[model samples]
Target: MQLLILMVVLLALTTFGFRLGRGRAIAASGNNPRLLHSLPRYHGYYVALWSGLPALFLIAAWLMLEPSLLHSAVMSALPADLQGLSEERLALVYNEVRNVARYGHVPSTDAVGQAAAGYIGVRDTVFLSVAALALALAVAGLAFARKRIEVELRARNRVESVVKVFLVLASLAAIFTTIGIVLSLLFESLRFFQAVSIFEFLFGTQWSPQMAIRSDQVGSSGAFGAIPLFTGTLLISGIAMLVAVPLGLLSAIYMSEYAAPKFRSVVKPLLEILAGIPTVVYGFFAALTVAPFFREIGASMGLSVASESALAAGMVMGIMIIPFVSSLSDDVITAVPNSLREGSYGLGATKSETIKQVVLPAALPGIVGGVLLAVSRAIGETMIVVMAAGLAANLTANPLEAVTTVTTQIVTLLVGDQEFDSPKTLAAFALGLVLFTVTLALNVVALSIVNKYREKYD
Candidate 1:
């Protein structure tokens, strides 16, 4: 809490110092307006950047490195016999240490608890010392920079350059985070591929993931074929798109082209409420309502349907995505130039015809973008499938049968007690990589289509 408060105080002080520096620079230049380089706000921004950025960078770097350093030190202090433990076992020990340090009570041996408490004390002392030093340096630097503000400082241009650098850093952070995730997934998937052949995982129909814990265990060589999971995911996604696209597009068309202002104002918000509905709630709705309904309907039609069917989950997911597609499509449709509609109307086209022929084509790119966004949402959906799509990985395309998706398998694989290094558990990472690749490819294709459509208009 003290650290948080210190950070907040630092931010406020930095902002105040920047404003003061800018004001001072502006006042000093009042006698010679032509000598000023840039706006007063820019000058202020420059000072704030210098005051906060370096200290923040130092703090971030220290925080990241400190944890690993502390962990390594604690591990080294452990008995020599314990030091030879596997990485997973070491992680368990670390977790116990963390718990003991946090609660001041050991769930295990008293000696271990004492060791944890000692480690925690040392870690906290070191962290606080470093933080204090950093804070003091930041304060001294801020004061020095504030004293340097003057008419000839070119503070505004300097500030603008700093702002640009900050923006670029922010973007780089996001890109780096994405790259990190991909690399982690790739390495884990590579581990999984070593255990199970890529061809078998990609094309084989069976997906029994119960592997041997011991060398003597029977039926331990579990097949890692991923065909069924992929099929189930595709089936569910297809069903969801079928339910979402037409309804969302029609709603968007009505709202953009025909609805009165009063009706649209009321309806648009109501439509968006679907997006606000918690996905867990949608999950239960799929499990309790849609699944049972489908089963009953299938019975009436003399066809077999599992109690937990893909159709139920997919349909609910589609309903959840409708607002996403409709709202985005409506915005793009409304943005279409008025001249196109007018020309169509002059050619004896009705309102519906003008919208269908002129507005929709003009807005096709953005609408495709919206639909692709919805597709990504569908692919990544978890809760609805977990509840309504049963854990049977059926390779068949029949949506009525019980089938499992990649997300469902990943959840099941990681949910309970498991060994992360085992083929069974690491399979989740491989599935995740495949899922990521598929979604990325879909996005690329969708964006390409949207860009081409946009180019036509341009």
Candidate 2:
């Protein structure tokens, strides 16, 4: 709340700085705007940028350091014995102090009360000091910028340079974050591979991660084969593609080629509305509605059907992915040049023939790209598979049987209170690495195909 109040105060001050700068520029120009190099608004923006940027940078740095500095100060003041607590115990103590400081709750004991009181005092003092310093810096910046607002001043160029630097920093931050995550996963997966062989993890038919909680507890017979996991993922994704590709393509064709403008506008949004529905809701519908429907149909035909089957999950997943294929395909198909169709018509080709020879071919790359995207979505899906397909890593190709995919297994292995040093937890990282690699490969292949066909179209 204090931070919010400080931000609001700084915002008002920045607005005042903008008005001050604009008024100064106008006064310096003797009310002749042409005398100024840049527009009056640019001078105002220059002051606003200068006034806000440095103060925002200071506040950001203060917020980052304030917690750790306060934590250390509070801990140093603790009793010698209390200060000797383990790192985990110290963390708990810090949480208590923070909770008390934020909520002003009465501590259960005198010791805790003293710590919380100390934390509150230090936090309030720091907040006020930092807030004062930030405002003073902003005011100084405002004055400097206002004084520089002259006929030859290039305020807009300076502002743009600052913006470009910020954008580059933001991009670098995102890239470094991704690199950090991938490196962490790679390192953990290497640890897992030390316990279990890469060959076993990749080609083994069984995946029993729970059987080994400790390094010494692992048995040679403990199934770590990831064949079933890979197979299950492929089966479900293949089934999803079977359902999605045809239906989505047909819908796209009808919407783009056959439907009138009014009908297309109304129905397109309605179809795409399915994409907006949450995956959890789809999971619930699949488990309660789709699974039972499939079982009943199988029973009537004297066939055995698992209560939780991949077929239900894949079908539901396909339905979820339909919009991706339909929407992108529609856009690409609509983008097919009218001259191609006209030439086909001039060559005595029928409407369907022109569509088949010219339109579909022209849009084929985009259609393939969209289907590849849908395939990725189907492969990464967790909730629908978890709810509709059981967690059994059965190595059968039968969609009627219960099976689990790599993503579901990753979730299962990482869910409970397991030690990170154990093979079971490490297996999650291994599975994640494989999933990442496979997704990367798929993206490469998709991009390659898209590029190849794009050249022809271009």
Candidate 3:
């Protein structure tokens, strides 16, 4: 509530700054546009940025740093015994203090309650002081900016420089975030590897993570083999790609080449609606409808099938991803220059022959890129597989049997309050790392294909 109030006040001040600065610029320029260095609106934006940006930035910084600083201070002021406690115990103690402060209820410990009260007092004091300082700075910035708005002042350049810096920071944020995720995955995976051999994890076929609770437990050998998982993921994802590629590409080709504009507009959105449906809904459909249907058909054919089979999951997942392939391929195929089609017609070639020989070849790179993206989506899928394909890591290529995926296993291992030190929990991280590596490798291959084919056209 307090933060929201601060934001509202700052926004009002910024608006006031815009009006006052524009008025100041007009008064200085004698209400003549040609006399000013930059437009009056730019000067207004300049003052608004001055009035709001510094205070906004400072308030954000203070909010992020306040909890840690106050927690440290509260800890320091505790009794000798509490101060001497281990870090973990001290953390628990601080949590109790926070609870007391928030609820204003007596804690089990009186000392902790007093400290919590003190924390509340100090926090409120600091918050009020900072809000006051922010308002003061905003006022000062507005006054300075309004005074600086002259016929000679370059407000446009100053505002654009700030905009340029903001854009650069936004780009750097994405790059740095990618770096951070890779580093975290790598470190946790290294920890898991320290406990379990990477060679065993990659090659061994058995997949039990809970059989070995303790290293010294009798007849309890822990198995962390990931080959079964790899095969299962590949099998299901390959099935999905097989279903998606031909259907999606053909739909794209037909829509782009044969359909009229009005018909295309109506049908395209209805087709893309599949992409908006939640994966959990797809999972429900697979589990309740598709799985049983497949089982009955297989039973009639004298073939036994599990209630939850990879075929059902992979088929539903393929249907879900078809929009991805179709939409991108449609755009790419439509982007092919009309001159090529015109020349093909000039050569007395049929539309089907031209599409098959020239158009598809021209759009192959983009189509491949879309297909690769759909393949990644299929591999990363979890809910549909979990509901339609049971969590049995059977090392087989058959799509009609129950098989689990790396994503499903990762969710299963890390769902509860399991300790991170256990191999079961750590296994999730290792799986994530491998998944990341594989996805990165796939992206590299896709980029290479795109670049290779792109150069031919250029």
Q: Give the top-scoring candidate (lDDT).
A: 3
Per-residue lDDT tens digits of candidate 3, residues 285-332?
999999999999999999988888888888898999999899989988
lDDT of 3 at 168: 100
Q: Name the lDDT value of residue 134 in candidate 3.
A: 94
lDDT against the true structure, per candidate, is: 0.85, 0.88, 0.88
Model 2, runs deviating above 4 Å: 30-35, 212-221, 451-458
What TM-score number comes out for model 2? Answer: 0.95
Q: Which ten residues in a row have the lowest lDDT in candidate 2?
A: 212-221
What lDDT, from 0 to 1, does candidate 3 have?
0.88
Report backbone clashes per prediction: 1, 1, 0
Q: Pick the candidate with the highest TM-score.
A: 2
**What lDDT tens digits, residue by residue, belong to model 1 across residues 1-458?**
65687689779878887877677777878856567776666667767776787678777887888888878777877776667899998788877887788776644865467669768877888878877876776677677777777766777667767778879999999999999999999999999999889999999888989876676654369878889998899899999999999999999999988899999999999999999999999999999998999999999999999998888888999999999889989988887888899999999999988887889878988898889978988998999999889898788888888889999999999998887798999999999999899889878877887677667665
lDDT of 1 at 273: 100
- The estimated TM-scores of all candidates read 0.86, 0.95, 0.93
Per-residue lDDT of model 2, residues 1-458, tens digit only: 88998899889989998999888888888999889888888889899998998999999999899989899879987777778899999888878877887898767667778888898889889989999999999999999998888877887787778889999999999999989989999999999999899999998877877664566764433668899999999998898889888999999999998999999999999999989999999999989999999999999999899989889888899898889889989988988889999999999999889889989988888788778878888888888887777888899999999989999998888886888887878998999999888887777777787777668766
**Candidate 1 collision pairs:** 46-159
